[model samples]
Target: MEKDRLVRFVGKVMEESGFKVYKDFKTSRYIIDIYGVLPTIVGDMGVVVACKNYDEHWEVGLDVLKEMEMIGKTLKASKIVVITTSYFTNSASNYAGRRNIKLIDKDGLVTIAKKFSKKENEIYETNVIDENEDSETYIPSTKSSKGPSIFHAGKRSLSKSGRSKSVGRNLNLGNFMQGFKGIMSNTVALIIIVLLLSSLITYIIGLFNKNTALIGVSKILSSAILSYGLVFYADRDPNVVLTKGTIVFFVSMIIYVVLIVLL
Candidate 1:
C-alpha cells in the first residue's frame, strides 16, 4: 500500500473507533500523518499516529519508535501508534512495549482492513500481507479496568477536582524539596544565605540605632553580593558577573535614595 493510502486507512479506523480524526496534522516540529482525539466526560484523550509504507523485506526500527514517542510527548497525546506495511524489529517492539506505544504490523493491518471493508460493505483486496499469517493487534495494557465515566456528572466533577488539587500540592511540595536539596549542596548558595542573614541583622541594628547611613550601606552591599553570587553560581562569565554586580550596586543605591525621600 502507498503511504497516503495507509494514512487514510488508519484515520478511518480511528474514526470508526469514535475518534475525531485529522489527517496530516502539523505541529511546530513535525507533520503527523494522523491525529485523533477521543472526547469523554472527564477529558479529551489524544492519539498521535505515524504510518510507514515499507516493503516486506524492510522493518521498522527503534529510531522510528523513539521519534513517534517524542511527537506524542510534544502533543501531550494519551496514546502513540505506528502502523506499518511490514513488521517491526525486536528492539523496536521491546521499546514500544516499555513506552506504551502501539505497533501494528502488516498482519494487524490486514485484520483492520478486512474489518473496515466489512463495515463499509466494500471489497478490500491487498497482496501485501500473507494469507496464512496470524492477525494480532498489540494494545498496551492499561491499569484502569473501568474507563472514564459519562454518568454521575456531579460526583465525577467533585472527584476530579479533588485529584487535581492533591496532585498540585504534591507537585509543589516535591519541587520545594528538590530546590532545597540543590541549595544545600551548593557552596555559593550557602554563602548567599549567610550574606542575606547578616544583612538582615545589620539592617535591624541600624534601624534601632537610627543610623540611616549604616542601613543604606548594608542594603547596597547585600544586593550586590546577592547578584554576584547568583551570576557566579549560574556559571556565567566573570565579566558578566562584574557588570551585573556594578549595575546592581548602583540600582540599590538609587532605590535607597528614593525610599528615603518618599518616607
Candidate 2:
C-alpha cells in the first residue's frame, strides 16, 4: 500500500519533469510501473523504470537489480532506472555496474525524478531532442563536458543571474574560497580603513565618558564598519578565501570580543 503511494509519488515527479509516463507495462518476467522518456530523447527512445516499496529490505540486493537489468535490456531500454524506497547495498551497486544498469534509491529516485521532471517541463522547447545533442547529454560517457547544460529551458547557455547570484548562496569549501576571492576584490581597502577607524573609535570611547549615548552610537558604527569591512574584503577578493576560514575567523572574533568584555 505504502509502496504504491511511493510509486505514485515518483510517477507524479516524473510526469511533471516532462517525461511521458506509460504505467503498468508487463515485461516477460516482471511488471514495470513507470516507463518514461529520457531527457535527451524525443520521438521513440525511452528509459525503463522498476518501482519497489522496500518495506522488508534494508537494501536492494544484486540479484533483484540484476534481474530487472536483464529484463530492461530485453525490452531495449536505453537505461534501467530502479526506483526503490530502500537504498542499494555495495554489492548491489557493483552488480548493477557489472550489468551497466542505473539504480536510484529512495533519495536518488527523488533526485532523478526531480531532474527528469525539470527537463520535461521545458515548455519553451516542445520539439524532439536533437539526436546528437541529446545523446551527448543523456548517455554516461567521459566525452561529456564538465558543465554540459542539457534538457534546460532553452538555449543551453548560462545566464548572468545564474553566474552572478553567488552572493547569498550557501557555498562549500571550494565555493567559499571562490566567493571570498570575489569579496576581497570588491572591498579590500575599505575593510582595512574600517578596521583602523574602529580601533580609533574604540580608543575614543575609552577616553570620553561624557556622553554615554554618543559613545554607544559610535561603538555601534565602529562595530558595523568593522564587520562589513571584513565581510566585504573576504567576498571581493577573487581568490584566497575559504568557507571554513571565514567561519572560523568570525567565530574566533566573537570569542575574542567576549573575552575582552570579561577582561
Candidate 3:
C-alpha cells in the first residue's frame, strides 16, 4: 500500500481496537506516525506509533528508541510502538525490550490488521493532518476536555537538529484559530483589507492609466503600506508577517472570486 494509505490503515486499526486515533498526528515537537489511546489495566494508555515502509529490512535501533522515549515523556504517552514492513535487527529488538517499546515487524502488522478487520465497520474516521499542512500541529482526535494525553512521535529521516527545533518552537499561533474570521488578525487581516481597496483603486486607475504594469505596482505599494501599518501596530515579527500575509492573499482571492461571480 502507499505510505499515506498505510498510515491511514494503521489509524483504522486503532479505531477498531476502540482507541481514539489520529493519523498523521502532528505535535509541537514532531509529527507522530500514529497517535491513539488504549484502555489498559493501569489506565487509559496514550500510544505513540511510528510506521515505516521499506524495501529492505528496517531495524528499530537505540536512536529511534531514544527519540520515542523523549517524545513519550513529553506527551506522557504510556506506550510507544514502531510498526514496519521490514524486519528488525537483534540489537534493535533488545533496545526496545529494555525500554518497554513495542516493535512490530511485517508479520506483526498483518496480525493487527486481521484482528482489527473484524470491527472494520465502526472505525472512527477523522481529519488526519497532512504532512505539508504546517510545521506545527497537534490536533486532537476528540474535543472533549477530559482527554489529556497528546502523544508525539517522529521519523529517523529527520535530522537531530531539525527535531530539536520542532521540540523547542512554540505552537500557540498554529492552534489558536477560533474560526475563519478569527484567522484575520494583525498584518494578515490588514493585507486583505488593503488588497480589496487596492483592487478598487486598480480598477479605477485602469479607466485612465491603461498600463497593467503600473496598476500592479500600485497594488503592491498599497499592500505593503497596509501590511507595515499592521506590523507596526501589532509588533509582529517578519516570519509572522509572511505566514499571515500568504494566507490573507489566497483567502482574499477566493473571496473576491465569489463576490465577482455573485455580482
Please report, in order, the local distance difference test score of every candidate based on alpha carbons: 0.62, 0.53, 0.57
Per-candidate count of clashing residue pairs (backbone under 3 Å): 0, 19, 0
Q: In candidate 3, which residue ranges exceed 4 Å CA deviation? A: 39-43, 118-263
Against the true structure, candidate 1 reaches a TM-score of: 0.47
| Ten-residue stretch with the least lDDT total in model 1 | 144-153
**Model 3, 1-263: lDDT tens per residue?**
56787788877755644468877778897888888866543345567888878655556566776787677767767567887877777888877755547787888776666545422322222223233355455433322111111222222114334433443231122122111222234345565676677688778888899897997777666655555554433323356566655565556556656776999
RMSD of each: 16.6, 18.3, 19.5
Indicate which candidate wins on lDDT.
1
lDDT of 2 by residue, 1-263 (tens): 38778767666665544456778877767777877653331223455777778864677787777677667657756456776777888998876665435677777655655555544453223333334346544443221111211112222324323322331131122233433433333333334444466658867786867586776567556656465545544333223234433443454456546766999
Better of 1 and 3 by lDDT: 1
Lowest summed lDDT across 10 adjacent residues in model 3 is found at 143-152
* Candidate 2 deviant stretches above 4 angstroms: 38-43, 110-263
lDDT of 3 at 105: 81
